[model samples]
Target: MDLILIRHPAVNIDAGICYGATDVPLLCDAAESARILGERLLALNVPPVKGGWHTSPLSRCRLLAEAIGHVHVDARLQELNFGSWEKRRWDGLDRALLDTWAADLDHSRAHGGESVAQLALRVSSWIDEISRDGRPVHAITHAGVIRVLTGQLLGVPRANVIQWPLDFGAIVWLRRVRGEWLLVRWNA
Candidate 1:
């Protein structure tokens, strides 16, 4: 089965900030972004593929999901909960805190936020759910979620989940062949 992982459209979070999972609204260019995404999905030409759909609870993701036609608002697929750090500009954060968190991402929590392990649990759960369906599924989510999902599939050794690069609106395809996972292709 083919699984298409689409990152949410570009968001004008003022200075292109790292909003994480704070439920920010999408930018005005959302429609254009969605159109481009739709075109790309059509280009994939997967067998048994239907219209595009799937997204997190965030507006940016949800709007894009609907733009492509059908959508499913799955909370388990939501971006990592940044907790107290939500909406705070990265520049305003304390360097020491960021560094400490970076060193121990699996154990660190941003104020009321969840640890890396906690986020992984949710991601893992989502993966398990999707793997069971055994169909061509399209998912639109945050960059961090993409990284974590890819890292887990690749069996990477990073705990921070930032090792894989996932830009806004990027698309990555993963598939399972004979019970083995494979990275099909990725778009920048």
Candidate 2:
């Protein structure tokens, strides 16, 4: 089985603004992104996307998904919920609270949002829900969701997973062999 995880295209939001659950619009509309991305994906030496075409319900992801093909919008594929911090600038957020949240990587809801554990559970369920056929499982989702799913597949520690830089519109590829998932490519 192959899984292809693509981060949604860039958004129009300002830098440092905290947004996850909030539905942020893309800098380029879905069709435009798809037009550009289609060429890019075709150039890459990755497997052709087959089977499920899944995406987060956020327009940033859904739009791109729709442009490419039929889409399955699943809330579980959404970015981590920022709760009350939905649109606040990161610099404007409370420092102590940020530290408090950072202190507990597993369970803290600091900055008022879903815990990492909750995200793991949500992403895990999505993983379980997908078909495991040999075809690539394509999904357009948030960086947080992709990170969690990658961590789960590769057994990367939760705390370390967050440190991996994932760029907007990046593509991560993983393949399963002998019932084990291995990283084929990252941030492509």
Scored by lDDT, the top model is 2
66 Cα displacement, candidate 1 (Å): 0.9
- Model 2, range 1-188, lDDT digits (tens) per residue? 88889999999999999998999889987888888878877888767766547999999999899999988889999998978888999999889988998899679998668998999999999888784446678999999999988999999997888889999999998889888999988998
Task: List the candidates' TM-scores in order.
Answer: 0.89, 0.96
- TM-score, model 1 to reference: 0.89
Best candidate (score: TM-score): 2
How much is 172 displaced in model 2, in angstroms?
0.3
Pairs that collide, model 1: none
Tens digit of per-residue lDDT, candidate 1, span 1-188: 77778888767678735577787777666778877876776677644445546678888888887776777788777887777777887788878888878878887885468777787789889888866768788888987777777778867755644756677788888887888778887654
Clashing pairs in 2: none
For model 2, what is the alpha-carbon lDDT of residue 35?
A: 85
- The lDDT values for all models are 0.76, 0.88
